[model samples]
Target: MLRRNFIAARDLEAELEQWQERIDIIRHKLKFIRQLPGVACIEQLNPPGTAGGRIPALVEIAGGTAIASEENGLLFPPDIVILMLPGKSIEESLREIGSLLEQPWFAESPALKNNRIYVTDCREYFQLPGPGMIDSLEILAEIINAGDFHFGFEGLGWIKFESGSPKNG
Candidate 1:
């Protein structure tokens, strides 16, 4: 029984190693040759703060700069803004974002001016940690480097926010 268990553990380790190699290849392919875009991930809106947990690290891995201050507020104008409210669907998140439209910060943000705001399905992609986090990273990659990577996640895993659009709210 001991030998059997050992063999099983070794096999699992080898499989995980292979899986990591494949993930590395994908990461390598997604590398941006130019400057990384400044990204702000908002996990909450009320008294707004930057996303907590693994999101910031994941943003960096996806080839974007996660810009936030120690107080959890935005330090500078971000090129892209992502809303990933925990347990909220894309539609629900959109409704919440509409409220931000009235805020001076939201109204004048570079992301708003450039129409670079996005809403993500946090429950499905970003809420939990594990393999799903890989999908989350891919989602970020698609949003940040829209020109190069195209995993076809748009409209499914995420939606670009267009202010004043009836569908947004």
Candidate 2:
């Protein structure tokens, strides 16, 4: 859609092509990891919504299954939990998540127990649908397959949330 829009406007063809090539390269690199089985739950806080969006598709592309809100009713604990608060910084997101920490389900989830909970800066990466989505994809890939991939997006794009840590709040 973005590409078509740019084409229609007759501008940025070179930039769009560059973005497409990068996206294709990342997709190719993630092929093997995509075959791996893992469940991920993404919770958007500020403008709360389900995992029924582009983020979920990004998760799948990065090699994990995103548990949608409907599926959440089944009480399936996700292996990875991603907290997204659009327009907020990581510190702000962490502060917001502090309230959720007291919830039994969130505190006791496998992701929290295993230190798989992550907080993301949605404003820069996941908030709007644009070329930056590729960055969002890379962030998810790094989080989902920590051992296998590392695109250096840790501190800037997202951060691992250690439950109960003072720094988190």
**Could you tell me every candidate's TM-score relative to the true structure?**
0.80, 0.74
Worst lDDT 10-window in candidate 2: 41-50
Candidate 2, residue 81: how far the Cα is off, in Å: 0.6
After superposing candidate 1, which stretches have Cα over 4 Å from the reference?
Answer: 1-11, 18-22, 30-32, 69-73, 164-169
- Report residue 70 deviation for candidate 1 (angstroms): 6.7
Model 2 CA lDDT for position 68: 58
Q: Pick the candidate with the highest lDDT.
A: 1
Cα error, candidate 2, residue 74 (Å):
6.6
Clashes of 1: 0
lDDT per prediction? Answer: 0.77, 0.69
Backbone clashes per model, in order? Answer: 0, 0
Look at candidate 2 and tell me the lDDT of residue 64: 82
Give candidate 2's whole-model lDDT.
Answer: 0.69
**Which pairs of residues collide in model 2?**
none
